[model samples]
Target chain A: MPKIVDHEERRAEIVAATMRVIERLGLDGATVREIAQEAGLSRSVLAHYFTNKAQILVTAHQTAFAAVRDRIAAQRAEIGDPVELLRVALEEAVPVDARRMLEANIDVAFWEFARHDPELRAIRLDSHLQAVEMWESMARDVQAAGSARDGIDVEAFGVETQLVIDGTSLQAVLFPEAMPPERQLAVVATHLRRVLRQ
Target chain B: MPKIVDHEERRAEIVAATMRVIERLGLDGATVREIAQEAGLSRSVLAHYFTNKAQILVTAHQTAFAAVRDRIAAQRAEIGDPVELLRVALEEAVPVDARRMLEANIDVAFWEFARHDPELRAIRLDSHLQAVEMWESMARDVQAAGSARDGIDVEAFGVETQLVIDGTSLQAVLFPEAMPPERQLAVVATHLRRVLRQ
Candidate 1:
């Protein structure tokens, strides 16, 4: 039989390497040379999959998020209580573990780029808006289940929760010593109670 | 006197130009070449003022923070109430105005770099620790004045406040349309009340 190659798997490998390179070296230092070295592929071979650094970063972001998305999906399936699921759903977004620490680092690294590039900004903004909408849906489910107070605006709840979550992740990535995973979790949990009471 | 230039003043001007460029093009895009163009000077002239891009970034961060530091100090001097001062102190760190928006952009742009470099990481960490300490001191004053409930962990209060403050700035810089000055103020104000009651 002739040799068979899986294009998608190779691309996924390159994206994972890009993320690892980004995690080890900040986005500023994640050169194509470095990413190719991290991926154990020649520059020419890497280009066969990704044309440039920008494309690789975009793919890395999309793929890195899938981990958190899958975790949240699993939580939604296994948990029975809306409030409890909300907590776990949020925990997945935060940097409470090694996997998430990489994700959060990758997430923040992209923000400055988004500020400069319109395409990246659109992708980032769409992702955050979707995240907020998802949280709002969860908040609505919580309220409908009688866990949250009446008259709460689920949209506002979603926005604030997303802000706090982002804030917590930023804090953890920048100052991991002071903002341990436990403390990050506490901040989100406290936010849940404060918003739920409103 | 022979022709003389104030070295400190010239350095300050370069730092300002660095901020403008970083705010517009982001740290990744804010090459020394772009910064020189923004400053209306040749790269050689820029080299006379600073050694490299790394030094420019460090100086820009330090100087940009001075604006916030000055605002917080003025608020402290003007306000007689502790809780109110706490609110304004937190506000100075957030990106509520054009000036602070620039500061916020510069601030978040540094996070990924700090993650990769040890010296940068230490500088960033120390600044945050100092900020948290500043908040804790302010919280103590609030508690002593009886504005806040007794027995709250003032240290934890400071840490969480700083996290939210940073989180708000990160959000506003990335998505200004969603987090306006009014809404940012509301988030900080709400956090103040929630922590105080605890």
Candidate 2:
């Protein structure tokens, strides 16, 4: 049988290439032709993967978010305790490398686009929802395990924790040296520990 | 002799008009002609006010930042207490109304432009410096009042506090219902109170 290319893998490759193009050239300069050239593919082939430039942008954003989601999931599994899980989730959000830098770049770009693009807007909203769900799950499990304080509002705490994560990401991106990863982790740990209650 | 226009006042008016243009149209859509139209002046007249589009964008960003600075200074004068001053600064960053909405929109738009525009990048860096100064001032006052612990790392705490403020702004802008003004204020109050070793 002839070799079959993995569609999902190919799509992700193209998406990663799109991000490289965006970071190399600002989003406005990241033209479809430029992206295709960077991806080492024909324009028709790139279009075959994503219908248009907007779709490509959207895919790149979703791809980046999926990576973040996977990182968090992996971190959650690695940390046995809920308190530590929350810590890991937050630490993951801090800007640590070029990938994270690109992620932050694409994230703010998506937010600006959300003001105008409905599809991007929907994706942005969904990503927040996913974040909320992930935190709520962790909160519930922690509460059930009696690791969290009795009578504490799990949902509210979850939202607050998410805020810290979201906020930390912005600081890390804009003021990386100012809000170092260690500092961000410490703050997250302190906040989560306090909220956990005895 | 004919009356002469106040240069500073005229410049402020032009920057204000630039903000209006930004709010109506996205950053990319705000052209020199459009800004001139919004300012109710001829293109040449607007040119006399700001040399080019980049100049107008940076000045408008600086103007928006100045409003926040003025707010902080005014609030600091009224509050006297460091924690209270910090709270007021947090409130100023939130999306309180159409005017604030205009300011926030321009603020976020500037980040994307900063990714590419050297002038905008410098303005962003300066804004970060201003934030650090604001926090450092608050920290010193707090320590002097004996509300903060002795030997407090004012610079570190200041950076963290600014992260909270900036992060809260991002969350409030992204998720208004959950991280609204009141909720944000409460979260901030809790964080501020936690950091103080009183």
Instruction: Report, for every candidate in turn, its global Cα lDDT versus the true structure.
Output: 0.80, 0.73
lDDT of 2 by residue, A78-166 (tens): 87887778766766765666777677767766776776677777778788878878888888877877788657666666666766666
lDDT of 1: 0.80
Best by DockQ: 1
Write down the C-alpha DockQ for each prediction. 0.62, 0.43
TM-scores for every candidate against the unseen true structure:
0.83, 0.84
Give candidate 2 regions above 4 Å deviation.
A1-13, A16-31, A34-40, A149-153, B1-6, B19-30, B149-153
